[model samples]
Target: MTTQIDRLTTSGWSTCEPIAALVRSRGLPAITREYLLAEFSPETWERAEDATHALAKHFAGARFADEVEYGVLLVPDPHFLDTRRALPTELRGGDVVDERLPAGVALPATRPWQLVVSVIGSYGPSLGSYNEVTASDDFVVLGQDTRQWMTRQVWGARVLQCGATPPDCEHNERWTFTLFPGEELVDGQAESGTVLKGKVRFRLGKPNRGIGSARVAPALLIDVQ
Candidate 1:
């Protein structure tokens, strides 16, 4: 019998065809195409496709890695409480840091035109002693340094000093960042389109001590029309 998890996994991988199709249509690099198929979740790929299609009018004739500015946001899955435990170890950490909000916060009904791809995963339990999320050039180009551009904050009310309590003790943490496009003169008019790439790094609590895991999505392409 095919279990629910099995179905989900299979369904996710099934996106390979669409991804491949996008690669061929966009004339994207074969290596980046394979990287996206291998590393990101089905959810990310779906959003990527939507973003690409939506921006087709604006990015026409522009090469993906050479002329497009890509932006990727690592978003916590809103439904994590219901599926976390059952998710594969790799998909577990994208939870919201704010425990105060009730369950069932819906995903945005409409896709934002400016967004490239929102990478979904289990990112929380925010109550960990140490939490860190970083983005770099290996996968994507961050407009600024990891420490400067990345925003980190403690969310929960309870505070536990390091070494005062057990290392396993949990604490709430929230992380955020932004990306911008570069502009140049196009036929004497300002045009936006600068080549870039994106990737993510996440760490919670002590080394190898967190309950969740994360995966880096493909190089996201942002449409700055």
Candidate 2:
């Protein structure tokens, strides 16, 4: 229990793995803290296989081997619909006013800090299902399966604040929530790729009313532009 000269002392990388000899006997820094804590395997993925062809060409057709199968699925950065990125002053300019717009022209109103969005993995296994009947006056009917699993065009983040809001949001009462990134991107019933868009920051707390604003704290995806 006496080895912390700021880690990094695995004696020039060469693992026989006892967790790299217990992180080189606790002195730490064992192979640069096991690749800065990625803690790889598959025999340590050659320590990072030169980042698998640039993360497989930025996740093109994802579904690699050692990992990444229906993972890495972030969306919301389609240049933010290119309206100079401040959309939402009631949709400024392109104001067709929600007839699902697209008649003339004038489309730049999506602000709320562009509403935010992200996934970076997991566009699978969400399909839909939930049932519970009892009707005929006994009343119980629950039926669920709306079909927005994730991946269609890629837009549907909704977590506007825990269990549908109600004095919640203490970081979602510990279970935490916050997604924001919607307005378009939905075409992912499954089968499609590349959905990267970054720059995240949350630790929210103010704003209330069933959580209509200022609440973001569930993830921390940082500056990924």
Highest TM-score model number: 1
Candidate 1: count the clashes. Answer: 17
lDDT score, candidate 2, position 26: 35
lDDT of 2 by residue, 1-225 (tens): 012111122221223342234324434333443443343233323322323233333334322222222111122233332221222332122211222222211112232111111222222211111111011121111221112222212222221111122111233222222222211222311111111121111211211212222111111121121
Candidate 1 TM-score over all chains jointly:
0.19
After TM-score superposition, the amount by which residue 74's alpha carbon in candidate 2 deviates from its true location, in angstroms, is 7.3
Deviating ranges (above 4 Å) for candidate 1: 1-96, 99-112, 118-137, 141-212
Candidate 1 lowest-lDDT run of ten = 154-163
What are the per-residue Cα lDDT tens digits for candidate 1 across 96-174? 2222222221223132111233222212112111122222232223331222211111100000001111111222132
On lDDT, the leading prediction is 1
| lDDT by candidate, in order shown | 0.24, 0.23
The per-residue C-alpha lDDT of model 2 at residue 111 equals: 24
